[model samples]
Target: MKISDIASISDAQKFILDLYPNDNRDFSYVFGYATRHLGYLCKSLCKNSPSVEEFIRSISWLLALANKLEVDVEVSLIKRHPDICPYCVVAPCKCRWTGKKPAIGIKAYKIPEELFYRAEQIKREKKADFQSHCERLAIIYPGNAYKWDAIGPWQLTSKMQEELAEVHEAATRYLSGRKSIDAVAEEFADLFAWLLSAWGLSFPEGNVDDSFIEYYLAGCPVCGNNENCECELFADLSTQLVDSDKIKELEKLFLALSSEVGFDGDEVSEVLQSLEAASKSQSEPVARAAVDQAKAKTEELEKLVERGAKNAKNATTIAQAIYKAIENFPFVG
Candidate 1:
């Protein structure tokens, strides 16, 4: 899919699946890739590079992990943030000023009302998407008010690193029965937002969505596989392929699937694209077309439908295997 078509967080997840499906990778493997790219991002920032490419790479891996885990990151973001500061539960967070102070350090601030009424109202009325969440965060924490100019790139990245550490800590606590899974999820959401903020700081004029799609235009930059990356060892990839014909073909298929099946056409197209990217012999489009043929009351439609069902079942089984493999995997960043 092209950059312009991505409108929600699920779209981003599907993009990752297209590039790196749950073929042979486990949850821990994907998690390692996420942290590995995050390390690269920190190095990039430390060296004062103008590129935010590593940041997007890290986000792509994180999305993959979330997909495997069946975590709806958009829903998690909406529940935790809801267009406001999660801790303060208000736009332009007042936790520093309006909330009570129980201590004298960074974790001192505490929300007066744990049940945020306004947050609930906003969640009910607002439709959460990745772009809108980023926009809402910009408003809730305006750069001008937050001294975005004063905070250098290194500082922003430092905050990202700090959030990563907190994610580790939260996971540790959860393992020890001191914290909940939601706490770990919250840390992840915070880290993602911070990554977006750092990207904005690095390239004020660049669009994250467009840049992301452009980076993965030909799938894994290193291995050049759209799905099931073949890179066994870490490698740097500078090549980016642009195939307008492929894009046009995928777009046409998406439109066709939208009319054929009652599923989200973009998602189904992405699934097919993943198979095509890996050069799988099984033709998903053919199977789906047979689905249409089955609608015509053909005699052999039952066999076609069974094949499609098996493919669908295999996909789910692979996803479940990945999930179980990494369900207890710890954050290693």
Candidate 2:
């Protein structure tokens, strides 16, 4: 089924469960993997890289955790954000200038046919960046005074981190008999809310359900085989070593050329990360394809550099070409 057909958070949770029906992982293991992917999202955000894939992967794990713990994610979300700003009680949310802190309780509302649609509505109405969405949501839901104190990317990320830890702790407590499974589910709900907030803040344009469906409709992304995923066991350390060394050499050359063209270190670093991510496949054909793509990118870079590289934008374009070449080279590492 399409992800848009997922009528509520509960439905999304079930979709994730169906995706990995035989998954015997415990809560800690699931949470750890989710956290790792979330770290990837943070790294991408810090580097100004597009993080749509990272965000979707992280949410999938969290949804799995929610399903495992039987979290009423739908109610949790609707209660906190009932189609309007819970704090200002407005659709568009004008809390920035008004500085209003209305003591609003969670109001009940009929859940939408598609929960993600609510996020899309907010994105269109605000017409602001992701951080603005986080600010509005943070102010409305839970009504934390500290959240409004410093509304920025860092603050939102910090809140997400805090919620992540709480989810972990709650899970630990449940495992140790210190808390009920319901308590863990409650924490999961909080984490899911923060995750949605992060999604809104990071990706303000596209529908997440659409992206999720498109990405996963074709079985596993890594191994491209749903029946038995051997991606982790299929590693070739020797190939990896050779590729790593080659990448380091290419990185040095790219950096030197970028510096010669007056490009800053950050732009070069971002491109290098993208290239590294792209060239991680162990298959010989994919590796060869990556090498060919890298050579082409190097040629492009040479041309761009020779033809009056005036700004970092020119360097960025070259870097992007290298990244695309790497990404299109297919293989599972």
**Window of ten residues with lowest summed lDDT in model 1:** 324-333
Candidate 2 stretches greater than 4 Å from native: 1-5, 79-151, 225-333
Q: What tens digits encode model 1's per-residue C-alpha lDDT throughout 63-105? A: 8866665566776666666666765555676666756332222
Residue 90 lDDT in model 2? Answer: 56
lDDT tens readout by residue for model 2, 1-333: 344466444566666676555355767667777787776666555555636777778777777677666675555555445456544555555556457543343233423323346656654554332234344555555333344334545555666677888888887787788998766765665666576676665666666666766667665576665434344522222311235555555556566556656655554566666556534653466455445545555566667666777665656665665555345432322
CA lDDT, every model vs. true structure: 0.58, 0.58
Scored against the true structure, residue 113 in model 1 reaches a CA lDDT of 36
Off by over 4 Å in 1: 1-5, 46-48, 99-127, 143-146, 172-179, 233-333
Supply the TM-score for candidate 2: 0.56
- Best by TM-score, which number? 1
